[model samples]
Target: MVPTIEMTTTWERTCELDDLEPGWGEVALLGARQVALVRVGGEEVYAVDHHDPHTGAPVMARGIVGSRGDRPTIASPLHKQVYDLGTGACFTDASLALRTYRTRVVGGMIEVELDA
Candidate 1:
């Protein structure tokens, strides 16, 4: 596994898990950068860097979620580039990817793991 950087100090609560409805996404600041918190299939949740990996634009959070083969991914709204939510890997281009953050729900609150 690639070394996961400590994105924040402690797990900061962004919102309630219920706030992110299934098949939808929400944008929140996770430390110094914005992140897109996506809820897929009503069971899986993903937190990825909000910027589009291909264009460096703050648009990933607004992308659409879909599946390719057996993997779930998001398509950038600008250029339609897709990114794997689990690994932040761009589906079409191996040289590009976004940063991913670890997250969990605590007492109904959505928390993003971070460094102290």
Candidate 2:
């Protein structure tokens, strides 16, 4: 017999889908952590850490939202370091990485799945 582990996901409601403006970022408080919510188009949404890893500043919510080819990206407001919105991978630097959280929309509300 093989042993299996079950994984559970807890999605916390952050805000309404209409609350986020396209091509802009919004800050959402997930408990004590600050999360940056970016809405690319009408339905596509992404959630990432609001902290800027390079500057140690919680200002990612004010970062510029754009795209690198097909991948959506956010550039830090302080240093202009670009990061992939979907994977939190730094495009300008390889050593630094921004944390990302899973997000979904339910009943016209945005929800985020925090890491446990």
Candidate 3:
């Protein structure tokens, strides 16, 4: 007998534009992965791991949304570790970095590309 193969896609639509407000963060559960989505400047959308790499806590969705220069960032509520929303690099720690996902707005909905 032949074994069946399974294929998984990277990009997935998690929520609509209206589901999340500008300058705020929201949690999107992509299967077993928890993603934190944020709408910056009322236009650009960014997605990162819901778990804060420093604290290992799943509270990034409740973290503060702000920017450093032109790059958007989220400060971990637990330890106040600032992370770049674009590259998921920790500003203060510099040794650790969060995981960032590719996000895009399509038809007023947000789509995140999960890494395999």
Q: lDDT value for candidate 2?
A: 0.94
TM per model?
0.85, 0.92, 0.89
Q: Which prediction has more favorable TM-score, 1 or 3?
A: 3
lDDT-sorted candidate list, best first: 2, 3, 1
Clashes found in each candidate (C-alpha, N, C closer than 3 A) = 1, 0, 0
Candidate whose lDDT is highest:
2
Candidate 1 wrongly placed segments (more than 4 Å): 1-9
Q: Which candidate should be chosen as best, given TM-score against the real structure? A: 2
Local error of candidate 3 at 27, Å?
0.3
Model 2's C-alpha root-mean-square deviation from the true structure amounts to 1.9
RMSD of 1: 4.5
Per-residue lDDT for 3-116 in model 2, tens only?
998777689999999989999999999889999999999789999999999988999999999999999999999999999999999999999999999988999999999755
Flag regions of model 3 displaced more than 4 Å. 1-9
Model 2 segments more than 4 A misplaced = 1-8
lDDT of each: 0.83, 0.94, 0.90
